[model samples]
Target: MKEITMPQTVRGVVAMAKGAPVTLENIVIPDPGPGEAVVAVQACGVCHTDLHYREGGINDEYPFLLGHEAAGVVESVGEGVTDVAPGDYVILNWRAVCGSCRACERGRPWYCFATHNATQKMTLEDGTELSPALGIGAFADKTLVAAGQCTKVDPAASPAAAGLLGCGVMAGLGAAINTGNVGRGDSVAVIGCGGVGAAAVAGARLAGAAKIIAIDLDPRKLEWATDLGATHTIDASTTDVVEAVQALTGGFGADVVIDAVGRPETWKQAFYARDLAGTVVLVGVPTPDMTLELPLIDVFGRGGSLKSSWYGDCLPSRDFPMLIDLYLQGRLDLDAFVTETIGIDGVEAAFARMHDGDVLRSVVTL
Candidate 1:
């Protein structure tokens, strides 16, 4: 085999300043240093987080390369990288567990103490430093990341579909499976029918939820939710969501209520939509300024746990392969989530479509 030399400069979208539109420009992607890997990005999804980062919702890190949810083939590896090799297809994970954190010491490497990222800076064509989004910027044809951040998966699956499992899909699925512990015969209600919420509906169905109620303002999203295994749909724009969910669940409320929208109003709805001893899982990301005001008595009154799920409390090493296998077997409907396939240059337009709520996901195919 010939030694492959990656392009010295690759086209990537960067947010040069906060609250500004992302500009596609030539960026310098360096070779993998120690414990690093360069991935030949095959596909990356445009997520709300990238938009948030662009608007300075994430941090003051300007000149940021924006993208995280991605799937690709490992192009090269640095010294001491033994976990993956060139030619291996992979799904990028933000939570690259360190396995030596306090959480890991307690046998929970899922909450790694010291997750790693690329030590090298991928710069602009003019040699200005560029901060890769989430440390695995896949907006470019190629990106650099820590070796552990890339989890190998089945190459037979489409990169457009498999890349989604890297973020929102995994977050939603894990919220139901790992955080909510949705089980056979459980009555589940998902507030918000976006990609993550719809995946929660699917996850609940996969876990054998007897009645999966989908709530959303958009009828189209609800329809998509139904296709993803929602047993019932509630049009929040026309009806009271909590009451609608209660009526569907024999008036006792659902056994598991997942607040996937993250707003205080929706969180309250999720709080009130579940039966006693039922779990309430908050998988949605709320803005920092948003505050929740609930009765302390209600907190004690609720017998079950009220939990917040981070990235669906997922373990990338374990979930990625299993989900890929499920996708391959046609047991999980990953394809339904892909409403459109686009090129890297289509990211900005995809973001606009997302705001319009017209598509489930517009994946960027590199």
Candidate 2:
């Protein structure tokens, strides 16, 4: 592998501190060093995690470069990099699996504990070190990441749409297809019809689920869920979620219940809303302060699998290209996830829209 010869300076969105506004600042990106790559980001999506980082929900890492879901063209690759090259169109993924990790040795590379990022750092113009969000800070003109973080995809695909596969969309789709293993004719219920939940509905439909139920407090989200293949919709604001789900499933509950709203209430709803022996997949992320409590007997009596999906249990190398193909073939509507596209400076506004459920995703186009 050879290191790229040129380093460049670019503008990027930076969260200078917790609870402060993110600003556009000049960033100095160093040439790709061993096993790294430099990507000229075409588009990147604003995700809740980025907001979380900004709000200090993730960590105290200040002056953080925020944005992860992105698609870009590789500008150069560093020494020992063979998987991708300059000019290759790729989606950036946070998990860069290390084959030597224990999980990888067991053939579950998606659970790799030793994921890698660029050995080098992108710095503020004044030489302050910057933490790249999720190891793939992409809300910028260009970003540096591990070579393995760049998953090659069809260049013809819309960057705004394809970039989403790098995170939230992929997580939602994987929660249904990978973690839940939704099968044809299965009845599925998804609580919280946000981006991830809506994607779960689409994934369940793609997997041939017979009854796809979407539950959300917002009517608009339910509508989005319907467009994404939900056969039934339940407005939690006006209805009993578990009861509505059971009613839709002939009083037996669904075959699989996905809780995409990580909360004690929603988790309880999902736990009780699944039929006996039905699976419960928790794909929504919870804050550290959150805790769940259930009857010990209920846990044993359920006799079903309770699982948590990390990034939808997705193997980006296998899922990205396949999903891209589906999108290109008109089978998957990836474009539906992109509600708007904005310039890098609009990330803060996008964050507000995301919080208000005004958009599924607001992509930053470079």
Candidate 3:
């Protein structure tokens, strides 16, 4: 017989109502059962996804527990959990692919149809179930997740920088290196130069892109993209995005164009911004109500790949530690993405800054 661990109470941020502000409340976390683990979250980045949850842009699920991009230490593990153990420094990832899924069995775990999350519920003190954002509610003192969601990374890395890779950063990097298949001397262009777009630019540079063109309406974000590795920038607010990209690429457009904004307009821009047979990778997150319509003839005329990147099609088990190593070696500038650090209570103000595009990432340090 095994001893049953009592439920522990911790402070967490919750969106109690749609279109309402998030509140700090007490929540109860159950003992990890069978394949779950509890993580004492050290640093959780305030991502745009968390803001979407508050605005009900993701779904109608209210009282949502937010925060996902995170890094922490494994505090405890449930029985039969062998992937990670206590005292291990880890980065929390939402994709915990089940081996039995068709996608996983096809040797494509990145597109795993079935992902695992904690079976046990982490509820409010009143016993109301709180839906965790992306199945990871790290905006708390602690969080419970399926053991597979915990990806162990180099402990020497800064939690604030390493945590961003848990989501946005990974999405951008994978968009270029994985989905886009950016090759040496390729001309790459990334649209919407926010955190994700900037990361895509860096990823392109890392992959030996000859020309990295960044397009965005905001000069601040464009400047950030330049710092990250963009060799050229297009101010979409004034200049024609497609024309500028073509001009930068010797009038042929880029070899690969990535849209990190996730809007129909930006996607269309990406669609038309690439050279013949070039690839377009849509890494940005689009809202539910948004619809995209393109001419059927144009779809055929454009002889290239149009793909959507979910979490940059990343496998945390493989990418996390390797990227962390690159960061430690100074080959990858993970630290540049972090704009500021704040306490958990400062999330709302951080959200305001994120809304105004005043910050890249306002990390919540526990």
Candidate 4:
């Protein structure tokens, strides 16, 4: 293929300082080297992690390219790459499991031995090196990442919807299917009706959960929860979540209670919202400063698993395509999660909306 004149700078949202606004500007993107692939991003969702990066919760890496939930088409491939090719519609995965670690050695390659990431550095127009969030940053028209990070999915699905499986949706689904092991006729309660919480509701429903109680303070999100398959909704602002869940589930409790909010209060609710010998799945990512205080006897008395889900135990190669297939079959309502779409320049404003719980997901389309 004849190489055209590559633009020396590509437009991106850059966080140059902590607790500052992200500014869109021309950034210098180097040619793909080694196992890297330059992806032409179609859509990237504004996640809490992006806001955390701006607030320095992730790291002190200034000039960070903030975004991870994304779907894109591969524009170019680098040396020794074969997993994906140019023109493939792919969802980016942060944990591109390395296949030789202790976890992988046990035949669980989903827990990879070593994960792949971008090998080349993307920089600013002024020659400052920019750290791409999670090594697969997609908050730009184009971003570079390891070929392993790309999981090709059904091209017909909307990018804004498909991209969500790259993060929050995957986390929530994984918590239910992967961690909680929610089964048919099982009763499940989710303590939070945000994107992840609602996703858990959907996943549990898909997994054959009979009674799914959606708990949240906001009425808008409760409506969204109902739309996404929550059989019942609990306004935590009006009633106690644990008591409400117990009342609904035969006066015992749900079989599984997932703490999508991840705070001490919500976690406590999850602990008491489940029946004895039931599961408690924590999918919410908590801040570093937050601490939990629970009785040790309760831990032993529960007689069930207390687990945390990471990225929904997502194996991109396995889960992404399967979820996309489900979406195409009309079984999974991935489209319902996309509340609105915006351009790259709208990411900062999208962050404000996310903070206010105004939308399920604000996707940035290039």
* Predicted structure with the largest TM-score when compared to the true one: 2
Report lDDT (CA) for all predictions: 0.90, 0.94, 0.93, 0.89
Residue 14's lDDT in candidate 2 = 97
Q: Model 3 shows how many backbone clashes? A: 0
Model 4, 79-191: lDDT tens digits are 77788888999999988877779887897766664787887789988788899988877898889888889999989989999999999999998899988999999999999
lDDT tens per residue, model 2, 1-366: 443566689999999999999999999999998899999999999999999999999889798999999999999888889999999999999888999989999999988888999999999989999999999999999999999999999999999999999999999999999999999999999999889999999999999999999999999999999999999999899999888888888898999999999998999999999999999999999888899899999989978989999998998899999999999999999999999999999999999999999999999999
Worst 10 residues of 3 by lDDT: 1-10
lDDT (tens digit, per residue) of candidate 3 on 275-298: 999999999988778999999998
Per-residue C-alpha lDDT of model 1 across residues 1-366, encoded as one tens digit per residue: 212456468889899998777889999888787888888998888888888888898898789998998999998888888999999999999989987789988988766768888898999988888888888888998998999999999899999999999898999999999999999999999999899999999899889989999999999999999999998999998999888888998888999999999999999999999998889999999999999898899989878989999888888999999999999999998989999998877888888999899898888888
Clash count for each candidate, listed in order shown: 0, 3, 0, 7
Off by over 4 Å in 3: 1-4
- Displacement of residue 32 (Cα, Å) in model 3 is 0.9
Greater-lDDT candidate between 3 and 4: 3
C-alpha lDDT of residue 255 in model 3: 94
The segments of candidate 1 whose C-alpha lies over 4 angstroms from its true place after superposition are 1-7
Clashing pairs in 3: none
TM-score of 3: 0.98
Candidate order by decreasing TM-score: 2, 3, 1, 4
Question: What does candidate 3 score in Cα RMSD to the true structure?
Answer: 1.3
Candidate 1 matches the true fold with a TM-score of 0.97
| Candidate 2 accuracy as TM-score | 0.99
Error of 2 at 209 (Å): 0.5
